[model samples]
Target: MDRDARLRKAVLWLKKKDPKLKRIIERVGPCTLTMMGRPYPVLLRAVISQQLSNKAAATMMDRVKEYYGNGKNFPDAKTLAGLSVVKLRKAGLSVAKSETLRRIANAYLDGSISDRKLSKLQDQEVLDLLCGIKGIGPWTAEMVLMFSLDRWDHFSLNDLILRKGIQRNYGIDENSKKEILEFTAGFSPYRTIVCWYLWRDHAAGI
Candidate 1:
């Protein structure tokens, strides 16, 4: 099946498995979740987004891209890896985030990580590989797995928005991680897709 077909199949499977999710799918329309880019740039953007608001992250990314890519293209791993932390800091990145981006670019350049290599690895292996990087944790790795690797089963439990969405939609206490895990497990293998709908539902105030 194609990517859209796979997403449709996952949606149908989730709808049949859970009534809540079925309603969520109906209201949310379609799963718009998709891989945004290759592993290096995807992870690069993820690092830049950490601990910041979406608007802030996007603005900073524009600044960084303008500085390095003349405001058009996102720089490649070599270009990013060659940039000093000071230059990146000047481009609106914190010193720590600048260092992380450089390390990620270096990881891609040095063959420590790559799209081809990551595609061959399982979810846990990918998590292990990425989380070994100094600034990346499970949340960032999970985002890479979901968006970059297109691993539909992975969910970022650490995401506050997702947790709040579960609370509001499922009536599960946001503080009760185990209950949320159990409730979400019913959507297994498509939890990420279901979570996409849940996010939409929360955003819609339904």
Candidate 2:
């Protein structure tokens, strides 16, 4: 099956298999489930989304899109490398975000990494490899893995909503790695999707 279809199946299975998940699933409904474009652009978008509100990210992404290569479409590593950081910063990206995008582009063009390799890697492996690059960190790397690579087996423990959701829903005492992993284990292969719902739920105050 294709990735989107598989994701649909995964989300459905999560809701059906676990009644607790069903509550959020019913209210939040299905997610976008669409991840388009090549690896670098998607990763850039992931980086752009980091530590920023959705509105701010959307505005910055629009500015990036205004560039010849929309970060979503033609985020060619070579092209991005040649682009001006000052221009990108004027486009509304923070200094760190511009640097991160450059690092991602360099990693891709320098034969240090590729989408195929990222796809094959375990989540932890992907995290370590990407995080080794300047400006790439665990949370941003997880976003790249979860959204771009569409690795079903991902859990963004760094996400605050997921941690709070677990505490609220499952009554987990702490959001440690062990507790979070154990609580979210049942959502396997779709924990990121569950995280999305929890974030949405938290936003809606439901």
Candidate 3:
């Protein structure tokens, strides 16, 4: 299918999956499903952005951008591999995260990873490959799959806001992890967008 067709399908899927989400469309602006491109480093930057406020991530990314002199060309595996751990730590990355970056860079440099290979991988597979780096986990992997890959259907039931929203909506005081997982199954293929509205509603107190 063409881009327009795919986008139309995504819109229709999102609309049909949840009426609350349709209300979100009528109120707050469109969901910012911007693609920050496909590089691991780019997605890693986004992972760093997650949980923390956007302003904080921008500051850290600025440091990295300054180090590289330009954002147009992504610093490849070789470039990242050459960075000293101390320097990256000084740039506002946790020691573990810096190390994860190094491991991923090394994997890329050694030809164990390639863009071609990533295209064929599923979310769980990509998560498995990436989480080998230590700092990267399920949440971080989900963010990469959703944003950088432009995955139209993805969500993190493990995410606190979404979990809270689900519990609140269902009027449950608490639920086992298994119950939560079972509940979110209905949002499959659109769970990502469902989570978006969940967060938005929480923010708006609506």
Query: Judged by TM-score, which candidate is best?
Result: 1
Candidate 1 local distance difference test against the native:
0.85
Worst 10 residues of 1 by lDDT: 194-203
For residues 100-154, write the lDDT of model 1, one tens digit per residue: 9988889988999998999899999999999999999788888888888888886
Q: By descending TM-score, how would the candidates be arranged? A: 1, 2, 3
Backbone clashes in model 2, listed as residue pairs: 152-189
What's each prediction's TM-score? 0.93, 0.84, 0.82
Using lDDT as the yardstick, the better of models 2 and 3 is 2
Kindly provide the TM-score of model 1 when superposed on the true structure, using C-alpha atoms: 0.93
Question: Which runs of model 1 end up more than 4 angstroms from their true locations?
Answer: none
Clash pairs detected, candidate 3 = 154-192
Between candidates 2 and 3, the one scoring higher on TM-score is: 2
Weakest ten-residue segment in model 3 by summed lDDT: 24-33
Score each candidate by Cα lDDT.
0.85, 0.79, 0.70
Question: Which candidate wins on lDDT?
Answer: 1
Better TM-score candidate (1, 3)? 1
Q: Compared with the true structure, what per-residue lDDT tens digits does model 3 show for residues 79-163?
A: 8888888988876877776777777778888877766676678877877877666677777777777766666667675577777
How good is model 3 by TM-score? 0.82
User: RMSDs, each prediction?
Assistant: 1.5, 2.6, 2.8
